[model samples]
Target: MLTALKLTAFGVVDESTLELGPGLTALTGETGAGKTMIVSGLGHLLGARADAGIVRRGAPRAVVEGRWEVGDGIAGRVREFGGDVDDGELVTLRQVSAQGRSRAVVGGAGVPVSTLADLVGEFATIHGQSGQIRLSNPDRQRELLDEHARPAELARYRADFAERRAAAHELAELESEAMARAREADMLRFGLDEIAAVDPLPGEDDALAAEQAKLMDLDELRELAAAAHEALSGNENDYDAMGVVGLTGTARKSMTRLSDRDEAAAPLTARATELAMLAADLAADVAGYIDDLVADPLRLEAVSGRRAALATLTRKYGATVDEVLAWAASGAARLAELDGSDSRIFELRDRIAGLDSSLAADAAAISAARHRAAGELAAAVKTELAALAMPHAELRFDVSDAQLGPHGADRIELLFSANPGSEPAPLGKVASGGELSRVRLALEVVLATGGEGHTFVFDEVDAGVGGAVGLEIGRRLQRLAEKSQVIVVTHLAQVAAFADAHFVVAKASDGQVTTSGVRSLTHDERAAELARMMGGESDSDSGLSHARDLLARAGRG
Candidate 1:
């Protein structure tokens, strides 16, 4: 429920504050007294488009603010917008500049105007002449029916529809790229097969290159080994020049003889024996190395050929055998994915088929629920219409199958007939402006039952309606206010007479600026305002008497 509204520099309302209560509140004034500005201010507060032209002369900007009694339904949304709901109230503020810039604030947090719109249904529902026009829309009709009929089931069906839509979208993309994916898979397969045939091992390229270098210089290596062996031990033909091994042995014999002569010589003898052993070992190793040096051209060619093969792989896949192996591993995994594309496609197709079946079932259930609800809603509206001075009026819901959509597979339309024994026609085609207003009101009274705490604003809901019908409209609004806060802007005395609280918007001019001010009327003041609305002077005795009668009839006297 909206507790209050304030407007500054908005329309002809330079500055005004309306303190509201939780029941039917009526805004009444003479024509052109800016009564509708109250509704306009509320619209702007609820995120309607702001017009710079509405800004009052000499005012730089226009601002509209509202205070609402917060409920659990809107607390989460307020929190989602980074708003604070301390003290169980939410203050929403909107400002529009003459330069065409607009800003919104909810619960003291600045937000986009769209955030306010997102909270519309949960917070309030604005019904006016424009709303009546919207009621003729088939989509709007379907929405109202769903809102009253099967909200929970419709929610479930919509959720499933969203998931199914996403799956179908993915399937379409995969199918469209089928040819490209197939080509990619084939390329990966070929690369994998080629790498497998090579059978490259980690570090094999570097090892092969080292071996090939050694084999290519085999002759030089063998000559060097033979020279080292001859130097370490005496050559077979050059025995005159003793090698290190023979000379070391001669020195060892002398050291052994000296050690026997003196104890000090024993340490020198041990050192000489160690030196002789080291020389012998070195000589034997050199000899073995020379004997093992055998050069085979065929082996060299084999090593070179293997190195070239590895180089080919390195050129295409990686700079090293290890890297090439890594690529092969990764490629094999990707190839597996590509290979399973067909199976994945089949899986998605099967899933889509299953979803289609599920959607059909859910849509059927939703339609059935709507059918049941349509009958009840139509009958109820007819009853409401009968009370609103249209006893012979009939309302029918035309529920038919439509293509599956986000909401459901149902096309709903509201049909109406003004007289008995007449076939009901589409609401937009047959209903007059007056009939449309009443129909809109009837729907509101019916729907308002489900919206317990919502604030309902009706701007000229009595348009094109008056007399007994206007009285009935007032009564219906008063009844709706029993469960929801209803604020109406009217020029009809009949409707204003039924208000729990009456506010009169009066215009004042100081020759330079005209301003509209709103003030709650006292009992006598309300009668006088109603007298003015009845096209009579407020001071007329007869008008006052009639006004009193009107209020007494509505139980507000």
Candidate 2:
């Protein structure tokens, strides 16, 4: 239930605060006094989008705040949204800026706008002459029927359904992979076998290729080595031309002779001696390597075979030994899966069969319970309709099979017969606007009875009614308020006359500016307002007398 509302710079409402109460309350004013602004403010507080044009003329920003008292009825839900309420007392508020930014707060802590809307929704419903379109939406209708059928059971069923759906989805993905795998299974096995026979190791390809090139050029290498050795140190190429070491020794002896006369000659002599020693070491190495450089065909064959094995692995699996090894591991896993595909699929079918049996039983139980509830609900609605001046009308609840879903195959339709001897038809195709309002009100009254949390507001439900009918509508609204809180926006004097608290929405002009306002009326003052609604001027005697009589009767309730 809403405790209070505070508005500033919102629409034509400059600044105002309204403290609400527990029983029938009415708001009435002349045309264009901004009675609808209150509803618009409530809509904004509910997280509904608003137009910036609704801001006041001189104000830079608009704000509308509502404080709702949520006691034991929805405390758990409120706490779940990051708000704590005592017993069921929850305070929720919304603030909007002129720049189009909005904020929602619950229990003085900030929360998401959607959270605020969801939490506030559990408390009040804003039903106007247009009715609730969201409720009529196909998806919303499906949810309402499901809720009406089995709330807790449906909740658990949905949880299980999600898991089963996820498992089925996973099976589909695996099946697709398995299909592609099936076509390549033979090729994969053959290629893997070939690579295994090759048995290439990391870096083995480079080593083998280097060895093969060396073996292929062995003859040229031998000829070049012998010729190079002869040129540098052998007698064949060194007959008149001194070998490098012999020449260096001669140069060193000549420098030693000149060293006594020149300091630079000593360093030259030292360098010449160092060159002779290096020539000696090189000649020794050349002689030693000559026999070791022989090409061994057996070893060469082994190197070539290793190189070929590396080539095979690279071609079959990947560009490298490590990549081929990884493919081998994944192939092992996939082969195992392929071997067990049939068995796994059978397992899933068996599980699904068991689930189907259990779900069938659960659904049947739910259907049986719903059949009983529908009968009781229909009888109750018919009784309320009779009190609303439709004694001859009848209501029916038809539950039938729907699609296979978590909710267990139930579709419901409301059947209505508005006249004697008339065949009952579905509510959607047959009920008129006025009839719908009465029916909605009757349902609200019936369902909300003895339930937790109530702040009911009906806006102009008496639009197309008058006399006894209008009075009965007001009477029922008041009767409902006895169990909870009720507020009404009406043009009917009978309706206004029933309000324990009456607010007259009046327009005032302060020189150049005109503004709408609201003021709670006293008993005598409320009589004048009701008289005005009865199509009488403020001072009319008969209107005052009638308003007094109506108020007196409503006060007794």
Best by lDDT: 1
Please estimate how well model 1 matches the true structure, expressed as its whole-model Cα lDDT.
0.89
* lDDT at 555, model 2: 70
Q: Where does candidate 2 stray beyond 4 Å?
A: 8-15, 31-33, 44-63, 71-91, 95-103, 108-110, 130-152, 161-178, 184-191, 217-292, 326-344, 504-519
Candidate 1, residues 1-557, lDDT tens digits: the string is 88889999999999999999999999988788898899889888777897899888889999998888887758878988799887888888999999989999988889889987677556787887789888989989998898788655677778878988888888898889889988988888888788888898899998998888888887999888887777778777977978888989999999999989888999989999999999999999988887777878898889888888888889999999999999999988987887787788898889878878888888998899899999999999999999999999999999999999998898888899999999999999999999998998899889888777789999988888899999999998898889889999997999999999999998999998889999999999999999999999898999999999999999998
Clashing pairs in 2: 70-88, 71-88, 71-89, 72-88
Which candidate number would show the highest TM-score if scored against the true structure? 1
What lDDT tens digits, residue by residue, belong to model 2 across residues 1-557? Answer: 77787778877777877788777778888878888877777777667885668777777777777776765647776666677775555666666666667888887678888888777776676656655333233454444344445444665566656666666776676677776767677667776687677776766676777889988888988888777776668576437866776777777788878886898788888887788888878877886777668979998898877777676778878887778877887887776767677577767767666666666666666677678777776687788889888898887767788765766667767678899999988676777766766776676666666544567667766666677777788888777777677778888887787777888777777786667777889888988888888888767899888788878876722
Per-candidate RMSD, Å: 5.9, 5.4
The estimated TM-scores of all candidates read: 0.79, 0.76
